[model samples]
Structures are given as C-alpha cells and as structure tokens.
Target: EADIYQTPRYLVIGTGKKITLECSQTMGHDKMYWYQQDPGMELHLIHYSYGVNSTEKGDLSSESTVSRIRTEHFPLTLESARPSHTSQYLCASSEGGAGEKLFFGSGTQLSVL
Candidate 1:
C-alpha cells in the first residue's frame, strides 16, 4: 500500500467561496479516485482517472472538478462552494486491477457556511 496524504485535513469557508482539496500519493498509481461522503453515509465516487491527462466524472454528479496533472497528485476544486458542498472528500489510488487494494489519504472535511 502506498502512503497517500490530503492537505489541511479540515477546511471551512463561506458560501460562494472557492476551495481546493489536495491529495498526493507517494507511490505511482495509474488509477485514482475521489469520493465524497457525509457523516454515516455511503461514499459516492465523484471523480476518477485512469492515468495522467485522463479524468472522468464518477457516478455521482458533483459541483466540483478534479485534475490529474501529475502522476502523484490529484486535486479537487470547487469554483463556487455552497452549503450543500459540505462533506468529507476522500482520495484513493490503486494499482489498476479488479480486486486490487486501494491506498487512501486522510480525508478533507469541508464545511461551507
């Protein structure tokens, strides 16, 4: 398993504010994903990429966007955050297989007030 880290661990901002959650992986992984979840709720995949320069929106529709400019970095950004955007954002990376283990970063808890 690779070590993944998310910066700021926590964030709070007013509505209409723009924010970015950072996620970085130590090990190079081709498959990466971002999931959003509220307290006690199921994780909803919001973004993912097969590799660099390849990004796809996941199952859940999101107001945020993600970019994979480097192999070790994936950052999620919200142009205009709202109260409805409050949630825990999780980042994970895998070796790209059906049953491969995923390396997850400490999530970023965002609060938009």
Candidate 2:
C-alpha cells in the first residue's frame, strides 16, 4: 500500500466555508508535494516541502496554504471556500535523490456551490 494518505476523499461545501485537507506519509520521505488538478486538465504544483519545517509555494498561484511540522505530515488549508476552488487535490511524497518515483495519495475532490 502507498504510504501517503489524504482525508475526506470527497468534499462538498458552500462558499465561504473554511476547509483543511489532511495529508500524511509513513515512508519517511523528505520531499512532499501538493498538486491541484481539474477535470481533463494537467496537474499543477501548488505547494511543496523539502523536509520538516521547510515549505515553499509552487508555480501555481493558489489561495491555499500548507504547513509541515513533522516529517510525516503535510496538510493544506483553504481559508475560504469558493466555486473557483473546486478541484482535485493530490498529495505526493518522494525521496530526494534522482530517479525516485513519487507516491501519490488517492486525492480529494472538492466541490463548492
């Protein structure tokens, strides 16, 4: 089984609500990332962390934020839900060396009405 885990496999909420997406890995990987994807569209990197206490914003402009306090946990939070924020969020972890494949979570699909 994959070490990474994401909660709330699916979410439906009204606009203006705050939500937090949880992600965790048991593989002890040093590199973790969060990706945003839309139906029939490419995945976009939204956030990443190289290690505990190290977090960085990715190429995509996202209203969401992430925090990495422990090596095995990385959670993303949206301050306020919006229709435009509806999409699939994937959490992945990888070993830092070259040629290491990323292990992704099942993903969380969010919908805002």
Please list the C-alpha lDDT of all candidates, in the order they appear. 0.91, 0.94
In candidate 1, what are the lDDT values of residues 1-113, reduced to their tens digit?
A: 55999987999999998899999998989899999989889989999999999999999999889999999999999999999999999999998842689888889999999
How much does candidate 2 score in TM-score?
0.95
Candidate RMSDs in order: 1.4, 1.4
Clashing pairs in 2: none
Q: Worst ten-residue run, lDDT, model 1?
A: 95-104
lDDT of 1 at 38: 91
Give the per-residue lDDT digits (tens) of candidate 2, residues 1-113: 54899998999999999999999999999999999999899989999999999999988999999999999999999999999999999999999732589999999999999
